[model samples]
Target chain A: MRYLLIYDITHDGTRSKVADVCLDYGLNRIQYSAFLGELSPAHQRELLLKVHQRLGKHGANIQLFPLDEKAWVGRKSIEREERQNNE
Target chain B: MRYLLIYDITHDGTRSKVADVCLDYGLNRIQYSAFLGELSPAHQRELLLKVHQRLGKHGANIQLFPLDEKAWVGRKSIEREERQNNE
Candidate 1:
C-alpha cells in the first residue's frame, strides 16, 4: 500500500524529527511538509504510532492518507524547477 | 471521487487567492495549505486549470490527488486542538 503523510509543526525541532521518521520509513518528502511512498499496512500503523509519540505535547497537525494505485497514478502536479525552495 | 489539493506558494497574495479558489470550488481547508473534498473528474480538471491560472509563473508547487472511499476513510490524523493555528 501507499501513503501520503503531511504535517505542520510549529516547533522546528519536532518537525525535523518527524521528517526523519518518515525517511526512516522509506517515505519521500513530496513537499515541504508532505511525504509520499509505499508501506505495508503493518508498517503504516507502526509509523503512525512513532509519529504520535514524537508529536506528544507539541503544536502540530499531521494527516496520513492511504492511496491506492488508481488514485496515485491519477495525481496531477505543477511545479517550478527554478524555485530554490519549492515549498 | 475525492481530491486532496495541497500547495506551497510563497507569495502571500497568490496563496490567499488560491485558497479562495479552493473554497469557491466547495473544498474544505483541511490544513493551512491543503484542501480536500468531493468533485467529479471533470470538475477536478477545471479546478486544476483555475489553480494554474492563479499561479501565473509564480514560485509555487501544487499537487492534486484523487482518493477513493477506502483511502479517504482510512485517513489518520493527529492534531493539537489548542494550537492557535494548526498550520
Candidate 2:
C-alpha cells in the first residue's frame, strides 16, 4: 500500500536520519520533511518502529498515513517548478 | 472525507495566505506547511480551486489528498511535545 509520511524534527541530524530511513524503505521524498510511496505493511511497521526509536524522549512529530492505490492517485498537486535541492 | 493539504511556496506571504485558506475551510494545520481535516467533495474542490488560484504563476506547489475515515484513523503519529506556536 502507498503511504504518506510526514515528520518534524528539531534536530537536523535526526531529521536527516529519518529521511534516510524513508529512502531506505524506497519511499520518495515529496518535501523536505515529507515522503510518499508504496511499502508493505510489515515494512511500514518497521519504519515506524525505527522512527519511534530514534525519536524516543526527543520532541519531534512523525505521522504515517496509509493510502490505497486509488486514493493515492486521487491526490492533486500543482507545481510550477521543481525544487533544485531535494534535501 | 478527510483531506491532507501540503504546500511549498517560495514566498512566505503566499505560504501564509495558502494556510489561511486552509483554516478558513476549517482544516487543522498539522505542520508548518500541511493541514488535515474532513471536507465534503464539493468543499474539497472549492479548496483546491482556492489554492490553485492563490498559487497561480508564483512557482508554488500544493497537493491535496482525500482520505476515507478508516484511512484517516489508520494514521499514526508520535509527538513528544506540542508546538508552542500553532502558526
The TM-score, computed over Cα atoms with residue i paired to residue i, of candidate 1 is 0.89
Going through the candidates in order, what fraction of the true interface contacts does each contain? Answer: 0.69, 0.65
For model 2, how does the per-residue alpha-carbon lDDT over B1-87 read when each residue is reduced to its tens digit? 788988778777778878999999999998877899998989998988898777645678777888877678789888777335543
* DockQ, all candidates in order: 0.55, 0.47
Put down candidate 1 lDDT per residue, B1-83, tens digits, no spaces: 88999988888998998999899899999888799999987888888889888876577889999988888889999887534
Q: Best TM-score goes to which candidate?
A: 1
| Runs off by more than 4 Å, candidate 1 | A82-87, B82-87
Candidate 1 fraction of reference contacts recovered: 0.69
Docking class of 2: acceptable
Which stretches of candidate 2 lie above 4 Å from their native place?
A: A82-87, B82-87
TM-score of each: 0.89, 0.87
| Candidate with best lDDT | 1
Q: Rate the local accuracy (lDDT) of all candidates.
A: 0.87, 0.82
Which residue pairs clash in candidate 1? none
